[model samples]
Target: MESEIGAFVAVATVLTITPGLDTTLVLRAAASQGTRNAYATVFGISVGVLCWGLAAAVGASAILAASPTAYTVLCVAGAAYLIWLGIGMLRRARNRGRIAQTSGTARMGSTSAAESALRSWSRGFFSNLLNPRFGLFYMAMLPQFIPDDAPHFLMGLLLALIHNAIDVIWFSLLILGVRLMGHWLNKPVVQRGLDSIAGGVVIIFGVKLIIPVIFS
Candidate 1:
């Protein structure tokens, strides 16, 4: 079990570090908002991961993985969401000049602290939730690590928690790295560039998600 866990940790670490939708979202949050909101996003993402993990443990994820109809439905929904989010980011980048002036006032406006955090959190949560890949990944990977004699559900949950923990650590490091460069990263031009790149990546992921469904 320990060796299996060690191998799982090694694999999860590599997967977590690879740039993905979550990475783009966190980087954009840190650069555009601050560490506080960025962490909120992280928490939201973690919760989403845990939910998927739970689903996998209970055999819920297998339904989506095995059922082409269900998977395609989720794939399309997730793709639409990603494209929508990406378009919003691109618009923000285009209007970054205006954003520089209006952003502060907007933050100070009726948007309360709770509201702000909820918005950021939701952004991360839904981004993860709507994607079927997480469900598929958790279902496929967790079984590989579970020992023959162990309880499947509990073991799957444990593995998922481990993956989530690693994700939190890696994302926190990314937030810190962005904070260290806050001075320049927050600049209007830099923010614009980051938004553009992030937006493109998001849209690409969305397109990738739906392309197979479309052609199949």
Candidate 2:
């Protein structure tokens, strides 16, 4: 069991550090909105992860894996959501750029902290939940770590908690790093650049997700 946990941690750590949608979203939020919003995003993503883990433990994810229709529906929804988010970012960047040119200063539109946090959290949650890959991943990868004698549901939850812990630690460090550079990051030029880059990357991912389904 100890070995199993060690092995799970090793693999989960690699996955946690990998640059992906979650990482991109968190970085963008931290740099643009501040650490509080970023933390909210992380919390939402963690909840999504736990839900997937629970689903996988109870064999619900297998249904997603097994049914083409179900998978395709989720794939489409997730892709659309990502694309919408990316386009929104791109629009904001354009607006900011225009404002900067006209007034010699750029400001990304601001929202109430509560509003921003809620939006960020919802985006994070739905983005994670609607991602079929998460379901597939938990279904496929988690069982490998379960001991023969262990309760599958409990073990899965445990593994999920471990994964979440790793994610929190890594993202906290990332948020801190971003905070340290807040001065420069808050600059209009830098903010616009990051928005454009993050938006483009997210759209690319969304397109990638949809293309496979469309062609298949």
Candidate 3:
């Protein structure tokens, strides 16, 4: 049990730090909306982990893994979702640097904090959920660590806890880093540039996800 727990921590740490859609979404949200919004995004994303963990524990992920056709279908669906999201982000980038202001003054409070948090949560949830790799990650990786004698439910839950805790810590630090940008984070030009980069990266991820499924 002790060895298993240690292994779970090590695996979770590596996986959480691995660059992925979730990381990008959280960081981008933080840059755009500051720390509070970023935290909300992290919270939503953590919920996603909870879902995945539960699914994994109950053998739901295993079913998907065992059925090649179903797995492929889901992978393709996830890729399509990412492409759609990337397109939307790119479109938003068109107006990224052009915050409406009164005369020459910037309207600091055009959007409320509540709205920002909601938007961040949306970004985080969709970003985490639609990343096809996430499902595969659990499907491929989690089983490797579980002993045949280990209780599946207990192991899965523990693994999920470790994964989410690591992710929360990593993302929190990122939000803190972006918060350091402070007032400069409000600059429309910087935000727009970030949107453009994020859009392109997400599109590339979508393309990457599709190519394999199509060819395979």
Q: Candidate 3 has what TM-score?
A: 0.85
Clashing pairs in 3: none
Better of 1 and 3 by lDDT: 1
Give the number of colliding residue pairs in candidate 2.
Answer: 0
Model 2 RMSD vs true structure: 2.7
- Per-residue alpha-carbon lDDT of model 2 for 1-216, expressed as tens digits? 999999999999999899999999999989887887899999999999999989988899998878999999999999999999999999978877676342212222454678878888987898899899888998999999999899999999999999999999999999999989877787788888988999998899899889989999
- As for lDDT, the candidate ahead, 1 or 2, is 2
The candidate, 2 or 3, that scores higher on lDDT is 2
Cα RMSD to the true fold for all candidates: 2.2, 2.7, 3.0
What shift in Å separates residue 29 of candidate 3 from its native position after superposition? 0.3
Cα displacement (Å) at residue 51, model 2: 1.1
Best by lDDT: 2
* Per-residue alpha-carbon lDDT of candidate 3 for residues 1-216, written as tens digits (9 for 90 to 100): 678678878878877788877777777777765667778889888877877776777778776668888777777777777788778778877865464623212222455768868877876776666655676677677777778898888888878877888889999888777777656766767677777777778888888978988888
- Model 1: number of clashes? 0
RMSD of 1: 2.2
Residue-wise C-alpha lDDT for candidate 1, range 10-86, written one tens digit per residue: 98899889999999998888888777778888888888888888888788998996899999999999999999999
Cα deviation at 186, candidate 1, in Å, is: 1.9
lDDT of 3: 0.74
Best by TM-score: 2
